[model samples]
Target chain A: MEKKRNMQSKELICTACPIGCRLTVFQDEKSENWFRVEGNSCKRGINYAIAEMTDPRRILTSTVKVTNSHYKRLPVRTREAIPKHLIFSCMNEINRIEVITPVRMGDILIDNIASSGIPLIASRNLE
Target chain B: MLNYELVVIGGGPAGLAAAIEARKNGVQNILVLERDLELGGILQQCIHNGFGLHIFKEELTGPEYAQRFINELLEMDIEYKTDTMVLDISEIKTITAVNKQDGLIQISANAIILAMGCRERTRGAIRIPGTRPAGVFTAGTAQRFINIEGYMVGRRIVILGSGDIGLIMARRLTLEGAKVLAVAELMPYSSGLTRNIVQCLHDYDIPLLLSHTVTDIRGKDRVTGVTISKVDQNLKPIPGSEKEYQCDTLLLSVGLIPENELSLQANIKLDPRTGGPIVNESMETSVEGIFACGNVVHVHDLVDYVTEEAQKAGAGAADYIFEEITEKIPAVPIVPQEGVNYIIPQNIRIDNLNGFLDLMLRVTSVYRNAKICVRADEKTIKEVKRPHLSPGEMERVRLNSNIMKTIRPKTISLYIDGEKTQYAI
Candidate 1:
């Protein structure tokens, strides 16, 4: 029997901007880092396709408990995109932490969240 | 009555940007009135990212995007009042508003910018046949509950409509540990951006049922399930195609309507197609010195476009206040021809033409390999070829002022030369 070649293609819609370019990414299993991207109008789509195929990540945005503010929750997001698989774990960790009021935008609510080296920062000011 | 050079209603992104731009252009004594308790408006509840990519050159969450403008307005010392609702507006640029701090105050302004934004279409608007249930909520209301009030609307959800808000809520509820059974869109193609469909549904494995709609709702006190049915070409629910999904909540994101009560009160002429005020190139409404932008003019897909249009209204208001705009030529009416839904700035003043005119429009349906052509009477002055066009995404075309001046036709019209088909299912 002959050995089979491990080659795959995946289609993705770029969410970087509203243009939503359709990207077709071809992956050669022989070389993990090599990816050929097609159907994108801009250069950003190439990077997006490659990043999406390998180590998929997403910016997690959710609300955190707050004290002394009229709002019960203050919105926060990971300073950078974290591993996609860890979103629920990160949310679980985020749910356990609460901050006092007078929080400013860009304030770090959690440094190195979920051991991902991504800080969770406030998205807006809470008074 | 209190007096100001410019008065902007609704302290959302549109009103904030308009007031700030007017101040920057030498307009003094500007006031922004917002009905919400906070200045951020609906953006405060929108915690998701993918905003401000065009204006800020970086992706920011909704609140972050609104906060930037709020900070700028605060830094510029522009006057604004939250929790204030404008009751009426007169044709002469007078505003009647009320708030807890200042009850029933009237203000006169040289220029007024209408930026009340838009409101979601509820279940009542769509008339989904079902029992009145407590679990039914608009997608925006659910967003406010989850992101703002820290409350989970329901454990199981069924979203009715594939608009951006519905798609976003699908992911939001799923991330919050709620099972979003599926999103049903009446149309064959989703009326939301393609990216939203992929990120919000595809990534999370949430099924999107196109050409389907909620025909009935079950449960007396709260929604226990919803009957989804396939619709035919005429958008009528087809018989014997009903499927039931057990869910506790039903979220409707059917469409948005521009809030134009004040516009009507001011005697501003409205375009029936857009359900917004008719204006010229300057963003000035039918009533002189009264401008409208953002969602009040029409529903916008992006906040960046809203900011750009609001800036035009702001600068136009400032120019009117300064008496700098002089009528050089009569305004030319812009007519939407075949394959086009409607065009903003229903008319254009030749003198008001800066360097170029940006015409924003949406096609009636999906088209491929289409040529959007702008004509001046019998001559085609501008044309651009697009590989793909959909009603979900808005399109913009820029016409040079030099070419516009040369033709100076009595009427300007826009039409698309292509075949319209349901190609986006």
Candidate 2:
């Protein structure tokens, strides 16, 4: 006699670094932890796989309009990774703002962008 | 004619780092000549992160990484001229350049470093059969327009080739409310980093069509659509496997070529395999007192590696200026054997080597469970086991001075032994 088991699996490619590791996430219904990650080359991939299976996030980078600078746009990025689903909405908010010149690199252009609590900072100095 | 101890051409990451290193090595009066209005070169338009991981131990955007070098260079008080283009370089180290501020200026330098970097391959280079259209743009050009110029290229996009630039643009355009239909790569496996494939394409649900290429571009004044076809084993398009994607923009990211026009003017030797200058262990070119590094020597995958190589070139230039590199014997040749595409520092003067030597190479194809064997005569000097090897990623192996004592003064060879695998996406 055999017992029936509830098992779910998902395949993912870890994007923690350039050496993208293929990861397999398995969910065991009977286990207390429920999720187990396999095929990771390092410990970082384990967290990446689990986060991917749960709530995915990404560091959103884009350009914001600038004034009084030699260049027309200033490159900006989120201070931290935000929820993946908020990328477009973040962009929409970023596009609405125009920065002034003499903005230093790492200057906060937008605070709590898109209500994600991640500030958008300038990627370069615009003199 | 103005004179300097060292003259670095192209004030990008390579030139900046090289100049800084030379100054640090006690060689003063260094000057960097840049053709652009600013110092950062192509990095100014690369607004994305994932740079400086190895060097800084933290991820940074491209401009931020370049700025760190630029700030250091400025702090060192190294003189540099922006918007100055070097027109020619004589074998005797005379640099002729022109700029708005200093028109037709000539500088006599004791040592010169070439760091002119590379340029992207255009549509004509790949020869896509199509009528002349306005919507086609190279991936780098599109990146510059969108990121720097603050202009939208198109609302609908179809990118060809899976190189990192192409992959990044697919995400960039999509974030700006553009529809990225597909990314078609002629090769079965992407030539880009694996992380880029996952983040730029998979995350966005943009289909990456492997072994596929754009056969035709359809539009008169603007690109209305494109026809993509699956390629066969021979890399030829299959007869019946054709799909049409109606996109207004077609972005090409085929490849990048080293910018070595000035190297040719100076009659420096170039390697056809790497499409860059043939350098020694010291990063010195065939022309004495002339050193080259970074993308001008060979296209590098990482900016951190570029900085490291440029520092070597800078140190080499300083040593040449001070006459510190004493050649005790004729240089020995390095040979690339089966499964190896090419090796940098094509020749080395073993007597001038320090405690160790680092050799960088790329495999001819993808391999599984591979062993990279370095041989001096018949004996194996060093062997490293790699679980996986791909042409997309460069490999580096270090040789210690202890291994140099066993050499027979013959040619050194490097090759891979493993099960060759055709990379499939």
Candidate 3:
């Protein structure tokens, strides 16, 4: 059996302001994942390529139950980054978790959900 | 100083719309001062298609849409000054401007408008530690050079910020024979529209780097390379992952800041988030007789939205001629609640209610299959279901004024409801 050396990966673009860099990642066949990145022109591209290849993380967007506020529950995101492969898994755990307020911005509703360092938190304060 | 009924600064979409509306309302004396050699504002440089979808029902280029308003202004025979730069505006509606041949001239009006639009956030604002090179330019500036001036920015290019302009420029440069290295973004998602992602980056096989930020720039007189690093939750650069890309040109499309120097000088209160004046329902600012619209209020992703907002502002200025629409203290102030980033129209006026109230907002992150719930004082006022939601695109939620008038909350809050972020509304 032959061992694969170099691996290829695709990237998703999200500058949020307009410079969309959809980068393509290629990992070297040798050890250390001695990676060589192509496409991006800035330091941002280099970093994104490396992370996408190594530990891909994402911010989970969901909602928590907030009582005693203007209305009902409010939308929120995890303050911490979820592992690249565990995004959907953490989202599942987040879906199951809900909190009641008075919740403030950056309030942690759930800590280390599913053993991932990601914390389901409030993006805005709810009184 | 010459006195007039209204003086519109900048001959962009907002200014032209305001001028025409003022004239329609029977404001006899009107003056539109333009800083450029011609009347058209930034629209002249944006030659790409995707404009006038809402207004004309067809995708026209930026210039054509601007020309429509320009032609209408000419038809009305409104008094306008081209190559005129309005330097200052005092509290008394006095304007001072200068031109190469015209020298200095001062004019006064019963009402004045600031429609100066916005400027692109550059490398300095982002503080991308790098050598001061000549090759670096903003995405818009690069577009102007390549599209209108017919100058290739670089043989090899790297763009920062996955903005609409940056993405479009990537494709544009590819067509013109420039090798776009990649488009880098600090966030994990693309900020631009999904359509642009497919057409601009995907189609060209151009890579979009997400959750990444440029940490350093390399080169002396001109750009040679840059050191980039991965960002954590706080967007701080990660250590031991520094990598470099060799390129001649670096374009920054990081963001846009509303051109509000004059607004600030005029003492108009500004929203720190949008970088535009804190405007109410009528597009009237804190300062009396001073109004604003278009990109001068906030960076708009779509030009049609600018027209829609500007038209209202223009009409509002005209209405001021016949009626004194004094703003009453807003009963409810719209603020971000949860998972929400920010909302526009910082203040909401209920008196003399308009047909509908539109609230412009952006999310802090990405989500799918969600319902946006707008609340007033702990009671659900409005909720709308959406299939896909992302922070890249700005969301406009139009509330029924009649319905809004009935339910007034001291603080209007917005949140998401669905399987992931389900909440009781």
Best by TM-score: 2
DockQ-superior candidate, 1 or 3: 1
Q: Encode model 2's per-residue lDDT on B229-259: one tens digit a residue.
A: 9999899999899889998999999999999
Runs off by more than 4 Å, candidate 3: A1-127, B327-332, B408-411, B418-425
CAPRI-wise, candidate 2 is acceptable
How far is A20's C-alpha from truth in model 1 (Å)?
5.3
- Model 3 C-alpha lDDT per residue in residues B1-425, reported as the tens digit of each score: 78888898889888888888778777778899998767768776665556787789875556667778887898999999888988888877788889887799989887887889999988879988868878989999987676445467897888889888888888767755679988988877667776577656765678888877888887889899877688887999999878789999988888888998888888999988788998877788888788899899988888888877877777777777567575546535777877777777777777745898888888766666778899887887788886556676778888888887776557788887754432110
**Winner on TM-score (1 vs 3):** 1
Better of 1 and 2 by TM-score: 2
Candidate 1 on B301-384: residue-level lDDT in tens?
988999999998999999999988864458999999999999988999887788978888988988887899999998888789
Query: What is residue B226's positional error in candidate 2, in angstroms?
Result: 1.1
lDDT of 3 by residue, A42-78 (tens): 6776776576557765544444444455434444555
Tell me how each candidate scores on DockQ against the true complex: 0.44, 0.48, 0.01
Predicted candidate 1 versus true structure: per-residue lDDT over A60-127, tens digit per residue: 89999987898999999999999988888998999899989899999999999999999999999999
- Alpha carbon lDDT of residue B356, candidate 1? 76
Of candidate 2 chain B, the 10-residue stretch with the lowest lDDT total is: B401-410
Instruction: Evaluate candidate 1 and give its CAPRI docking class based on DockQ.
Output: acceptable
Please report how far candidate 1 places residue B85 from its true position, in Å: 1.2
